[model samples]
Every structure is written in structure tokens, then in C-alpha cells.
Target chain A: MNKRNKLLIRKTLISIVMVLIVIVSLFPIYWMLLTSVQPRHELMNYPPNFYTRHPTLEFWKFTFKESILEFFNSLVIAFFATIAAIICGATSGYAFARYKVGGDTLPFWILSLKFFPPVVAIVPYFLMMRTLRLIDTCTAVIITHMIITVPFAVWMIKGFIQEVPRELEEAAMIDGCSQLNVIRIITLPIIAPGLVVTALFCFIWSWNDFMFALILTRNKAMTIPVAIAGMREAHGLMWGEVSATAALGTIPIIIMAIILQKYLVRGLSLGSIK
Target chain B: MTVKKRALMLVLPTVVVLALIVIFPLVFSLSVSVRAYDIRIPEHPFIGFGNWISLLKNPDFYSAVLVTGTMILAELFFELLLGLCVALLLLQLPRSRKIFQPILLIPMMVMPVVVGYMGRLVFEVRSGPINYFLNMLGLESLCWHASPDLALITILILRIWRWTPFVMAVLLAGLLSLPMEPYQSAQVDGANIWQIFIHITIPMLKPIITLVVIMRSLEILQTFDIMYVLTMGGPGAKTMTLSLYAYITGFRYWDIGQASAAAWLIMIPLSIMVTLFVKMMEKGEKIEQAK
Candidate 1:
């Protein structure tokens, strides 16, 4: 075959595999959305409707009625945690990038802290919360959730901060701007995209947490994930409502993830890719 | 203030917060791990290595280790293999890359707890889509998580489904960022696609391969939500990873001492891997700066 023929074959092969890859990647998420809207009978019906022509909102209604509180709790906690993480992370990131705070090991120490299994911390965290009389409260969960997000935030924001040319900040400093003012005027704007990416990714991560909320909060501050998981109790499984709750917890993140797709690789890799 | 002092001041809040929430809690967890303390029990006493000794003797702890080891290896192998193929495929068509990349990441975005519930529904042997599709292809119904043999396999499938996009994202980024000089040289020298991939791509991508492996392994070692939701560490502890096992021991069984031991056991290997990853990253950065 000619080189042109071979290239054609390879491109066709790539097209075929990509089609399959896209389908497998999308089907489950599509199924979750489908099952959430399907009425009870259609949900359990044999040879399940691949597409629900007569979709019903009953399952979503039940899901909202049961889980609206947990959803809000997750919203409040994840949102606040992101804000806290970004503030601390950006400043710490600035220090690490600019001043090499503490020592050479300080930033790595912070990153390594993130890799420590939450299981290790769970026992003490729960005990600490109990000791401080903060167990089963949003404040308690937010404090711990920060543990998950802060290091990631710092690393990501550090990468973004490092990208800002030092000369710009120095120029600002020479013109009588203080260090804080230099950061506010010069660094923050340049790294604002990174900060947004870090915040969004941090929010999704804190929202997706199950172990922390599962261990720390029982009833009052139960997050959406735990509440969604609770639908699959021992005796019975509420598939429809489970699907609905999963959809509720996932859709917004999926949308934001799509919007931030370009930054996600950087965010997920903790800036190693850049 | 001098810049150094101001910098330290800038770092202070994060350092303090992490100390209180992260570092302090870990130390506190270690101390708790050495004691026979259960919230339910009135008399909590220091049991000095008793929990660790007892945990080492327990068969279930080994099972958790074995299960977690297999999970990390299998997840890494399959996700990397498939992710590489798709990533290479994506690299072929820059025009279509942006359009399809976001679609590919949908699975990665769905919450793990939700994936567990969704997996339970989709893999239901009686009426699930998987078995239904299999039956369409003339295979008999096979129980997934309910079968002791298939439970971990089921979990691995769900994990790969969710995480392959992540692996692909990293590797694809690695692939796209390659210098192109080697590939151009290889093509000019009449190298085939496989030849270039083996001789150039693999060697160039080795660092990233190790990176994704270590990172993903660290994550897989902490497996909990999916197992908790789907099997509850059953059909008979067949699918229990260390994280779930620790959670069960600490929270469910209320054996704080033993649970903390199990948690620490998981942490040792994890800590070693993390240290190695940081060192490699530092070396890579050093080499880049030298260049």
C-alpha cells in the first residue's frame, strides 16, 4: 500500500477507537441522568429503557424532599472550604515561590501532608472534634475538609504564582508598593486564572468527600455524598432515589469540570504537568 | 519588615492551620492508636503496641493488604494501557481533541460515592444493564459484587472506568508536550509507528508513567466509598481494602486502638511512596533548571 493509504487506515482506526472510548466514557453518566428521571416502574422494568421517552420527575422530587438539606450542607461546607483554602493557599504559595518559607522542605512537607491517608487522621480528627465540642457540625467538617484542599490549593496556586514574572512584582515594590500591595496589584491579577481553577477544583474535591463527613458528621451536618450512599441500606436499595441523589451531587461538578477542562490536568496533577 | 520576615508572615496562617488540622491530628491519631480507647468504653488505657501486634496477627488485615495491592496493580495496568491508547488516539487529531476531551472526563467528575451507587445499579446481575447487554451477546447472567470471586473485579472495573480519564488526561498532556524532535527524526529515518512509540515515546514518557502510577496507587490504597456503598466490605470481606477495614474497625466495631493500628499500617507504605515521589519531582525540576 502507498503511504497515503496507510495513513488513511490509521486515521480510520483512530476514529473507530475514539467513538468506542467516547461511548463507554459517557454511558454511565447518561444512565444516571436517565434513571433519575425514569418513573419507578420503568426503572425496575426488564430490558431497561435506554432512553426514557415518558420520563417522570417523581424520583427527583423524592430525592429533593429527602436530600435537599444535605445538599445545602455540602454546598455551604464546600463553598466556605474553597474560600478558606484559596486564601491560605495563595498566600502560602506566594511565600513558597517568593521567599522559600521555613526551608527547602516546607512546601514539600505541605504537599506530603496531603498524601497522608484520611483514615489515619479520622480517628484523631473525630476525637479532636469531640473534645472541642464541634462534632457533627459544619464548622467541624469545614476545618477537616480544609486539610484535604489546602495543600492542593497551595501547590496549584504556587505554580500559578511562579508563572508571574518576578520583575513585575519587583517593579511595583520599587515604586513604594508594600509586599502585600505588590501581591494585590501585580501577582493576583496575573495568577487570577490559576486561583479560579484551584478554587473550582478544590470545591469539587471537598464536595466529593465521603470519608471525612462519614466519620465526622452524623446527622446535623451530613454532606450529600454520605446521604446519597445512605440510600443503599442493608435491607433495601432505593435505586431511583439513589440515581437522583447521585445526579444531584454530580451534575454541577461535571458542568464546571467541562468549563475548566483545560486547567483540570494542571489542577489534578497538583501542577506537576506544567 | 524584611522580605524574609514578611514572607514567613505570609506563610504563617497556612502553616498554623495545617499544623492544627493536619500535623497535630496525625500525631494525636498516633497516640490514640497506642491506646485501648473506644468511645463506647468508659476505661480508656494506654495499650502500648498491643493494637499493632493484634492487627498483625489478624487474618483480615492481611486480606485488606492483599486486596489493596491487587487493586492498585490492576487499576494501574488497565487504566494506563487503555488510557495510553486513547491518549495516543486523541493526539492524532488535534482538531477533534477539544471536542472529545471534555466528554471523556465526565466519568472522572462523578463523585465516587455516587459511582458506587450507580455501579450497584448498573451491575445488578438480575436486571442491570451490564448483564442485560451480556445476555444479548448470549452469555449467562453472572453475579458481580455479590460473587466473592467477582466483587473486587467489579470494584476494579468501576475504578478504572472512573479513573482512566484521569490517567489519559495526564498521559495525553505528556504526549502533547513532547519536543517533537525525536518523532520527526524517527519518521525521517523510516521508523514505523510502533518503533517510534517504543524507542522514543516510552523513554520520554517514563517519568510521567511513574508519576501517575505512584499517585494513583496512593489513591487506590485509600479505597472506601465504593466498597462501603456497594458491598459494605462484603459478600464476606472479599472486597475490603485497608481504608474500609480501618473505618470498620474504628467506627463500626468501635475498636479505636486496633483501627488506628490498621490506619497506621496503611500509612507506612504510603509515606514511603510519597517521599520517593517528592524526591523524583525535585530531581526532575533540578535537571530542568540545569538544562
Candidate 2:
């Protein structure tokens, strides 16, 4: 075959492979949507309904009316946690990046906290929260989520901050600016994209985190994941309700991923910088 | 003096919060692991190594260890292979790659608890798609979650699906950063694509791959969300991992001492991995500097 024909064949083959991957990747989610709308009887049919025989919004209505409250709770926790992490991580990242913090070891120490299995802190955290009467509250979840997000934010924002020249901050300092003022005026605008990326990451991670939410919250403060898990009871599986809840829980993150793919990918990869 | 004090003041709040939130809890957990304490039974005395000793003799603990070990290895193996393939394809795609990239990340961004729920739905014995499709294809409908043999494998599939995107994204970044000259030179020397990948790309990508491996392993060892959401370590502790065991012991049994010891056990492997990863990164940096 001619080189051009071979290249065409290769491209066509790759496209076919890509389509197959996309289908396989999306099959479960497609099935999720399909099953969610299918009538309960059809949902449990022996052969299983590939196409919904009688599509209905009954499950969606159930999810929205009852089960989705936990999703809103998750949103609140993730939002507050993201904000707190950004504040903590950004300033600290700036401090490390702009100032020579005596030794390199301190920054490494801060970054290394990210690797500590979140489970390691749960036992005492449970005790500590219990002692403080903070268990089963959004405060406890946010605080625990911060442990995961802050290290990430610090690492990501530090990279962005370091990329901005020291001379800019020096110039701001020469203008009789305080360190805080310099950061606000000279550094913030330059690292705004990075800060946004860091905050979005913190949001996604906090929103997706299950262990902390599952273990920490109860009743009124429960996040969506926990609430979804709670849908299962001793009597029998509530497949329709469970699928609806899971779909509701995942939609927001899926939307965010679609909207900010590049930023999320870059953040996920670069956020781990030593 | 005033400037130095101001800088210290600015840094202090973060330092303090981090210490309270991160440092204090870690130290407290370490202390709790060694003490014979339980919130339910507050009258127990301090007993160092007692919980660890008991855990050492528990067959459930050993099974959890084996299951987690096997699951992590299996998950890591598939994730690395699939992740590398996806990353390679991602690199080769033209401008249209941007369109598919976001959709590919949806799985990774979904909550693990939600992923578990979804996995359960898909793997359901009677109503699940996996079984339905199998029946359609003239095959036996497998009870993926019912048997001890298949329980861990089911969880492993869930883990691989959720995590491979993360691995792919990291490896893609590494691949993008790699110089093109090596491939050109290899091609000039009559090297095939597989040979070039084996001889040149793999060696170049080792540091990032190692980093990815360590991170994924650590997270997998402490996997609780999916296991808890899906099986709750069911089928007679078949899918029980260390974190699940710790959670069950602490929360269900209210045996804080044993739970903390189990958590510490999980941490041992992770700490060693983290140290090695850091050392590897340091060596890579030194090599870069030397170059």
C-alpha cells in the first residue's frame, strides 16, 4: 500500500478503536440512565430490559423529592471545604514559593502530609470530634476533607506561585507593600488561573471523597455517597432508588469534568509535584 | 524585627491549623493504637502491643492482608497496562483528542461510593447488565458478588475503572514532556515502535510511573469507600481490606485499640512506599540536573 493509504488505514483503525473504548467506558452509565427510567418490573425482568419498555420519571421524582437532599448536603460540605482549603493552601503555597522558609524540609513536610493514608487519622479524629461534640456534623466532614485537599492545593498553587518571578514581589515590597499586600496585588492576579484550578480540584476531591463522609457523618449531615449506601436495607435491594441516587450524585462531578477537563487533568498530574 | 514578626504571624495560622488537623491526629492515633482504649469501654487500661499481638493472631486480619495485597496487585497491573495504552493513544490522537479527553475523565471524577453503587447495579446477579448481556450472548449469568472467589475480583474491577484515568493522565503528562529526539534516533537505527517503547519510552517514563504506582498502591491499601458501599466486606470477609476491617472494628465492634493497630499496619507498607518514591524522585531530579 502507498504511505498515504497506510496512514489513512491507521487513522481509520484508531478511530474505530476509540469509538469502541468510548462505548465500553460509557456502557455502565448508559445502562444506569436506562435502568433508572425503566419500570420496576421491567428493571428486574429475567432477561433484563436493554431498552426501557415503559420509561418513567417515577425514580427521578423519588430521588429529587427524598434522596437528593443528601446530595445538597454534599454540595455544601464540598463548597465550604474547597473554600477553606483554597485559603489555607494558597497562602501557605505563596509563603513557601515567595519566601525562603529557612529550610526546604518544611515545605516537603507539608507536601508529604498528602501521602498519609486518611485512615491513619480517623480513629483519633473520631475521638477528637466526639469530645468536641462535632461528630455527625458538616464541620467534622469539612475539617477531615481539608486534610486531603489542603496538601493538594498547597502543592498545586506552590508550583504556580514559583513560576511567577520573585522580582515582581520584590518590586511590590519596594513600593512599601506588606507581604500580604504584595501577594494580593502582585501575585494573586498572576496565579489566578492556578488558584482556580486548585480550588476546582479541591472541590471535586472533596465532593468525591467517601471514606471521610461515610465514617464521619450521620443523619442530618450525611453526604450523598453515605445516603446512597444507606438506601440498601435488610429487606431487599432498592435497585431503582439506588441507581437514581448514584446517578444524581455523579452528575455534578461529571459536568464539572466535562467543563474543565484540561484544568482537571493538569491539576491531577501536576498537583503531585515534590 | 517587626517585618520578621509579621511574616511569622502570617504563617502561624496555617501552621497551627495543619498541626491541629494533621499532626495532632496522627500522633493521637499512634498513641491510641498502643493503648487498650475503647469509647464504649472507657475503663480499659493502657496496654502497649496488646492489640497488635491479638491482630497478629487473627485469621481475619491475615485474610484481609491477602485480599488487599492481591486486589492491589491485580488492580495495579490492569490499571498500568490499560492506562499506558490509553495514554499512548491520547498522545497519537489529533486535535479531536480534546473532545474525548473530558468524557474519559468522568469515571475518575465520580465518587467512589457512587462508583461502587454503579458497579453493584451493573454486576447484580439477576437484573444487572453484565448478566443480562451474558445471557444474551448464550453464556452463563455469573453471580459476580455472591461467591468469595469473585467478590474481590468485582471490587478490583471497580477500583481499576475508577483509578486508571488518574494513572493515564499522569503518564500522558510524562509522555508529553519526553523529548522527541530519542524516538527519531531509534527510528533512524531501524527500531520498531514496540522496540522503541521498550528501550526508550519506558526508561524515560520510569520516575513518573513509579510515582503513579506508589500513589495508587497507597490509596488501594486504604480503600474503604467502594468496599463499604458495595459489599461491606461481605461473603464471609472475602473482600475485607485493611481499612474496611479497621472501620468495622472501630465503628461496629467499638474496638478502638485493634482498629488503630490495623490502621497502623496499613500505614507501614504505605510509609515504606512513600519513602522509596521520594528517594526515586530525588534521584531523578539529580539526574536531570546532571544532564
Report the number of the highest-DockQ candidate.
1
* lDDT by residue (tens digit), candidate 1, A53-130: 889988899878988999999999999999999999988898898887876688888888778688888998888888
What stretches of model 1 exceed 4 Å from their correct place? A1-6, A176-178
**Scoring model 2 with DockQ, what do you get?**
0.63
Could you report the DockQ of all the candidates, in the order they appear?
0.81, 0.63
Once fitted onto the true fold, the runs of candidate 2 whose alpha carbons sit more than 4 angstroms away are A171-181, A270-274, B1-5, B280-291
List TM-score per model, in order: 0.97, 0.94
Query: Native contacts retained by model 2, as a fraction?
Result: 0.62
Candidate 2 total steric clashes: 0
* Shift of residue B23 alpha carbon in model 2, Å: 2.3
Per-residue lDDT of model 1, residues B125-178, tens digit only: 888899999999999989999999999999999999999999999999999889
| Per-residue lDDT of model 2, residues A1-274, tens digit only | 6998988787778777877887877877887888788888787777677786578888899999986668778999999999987887776776776564534566666666777787788888888888889988999999998887877777678778877888888988998999778878888899897888788888888888877877788878898878877887532677777778788888887887766666775676544432
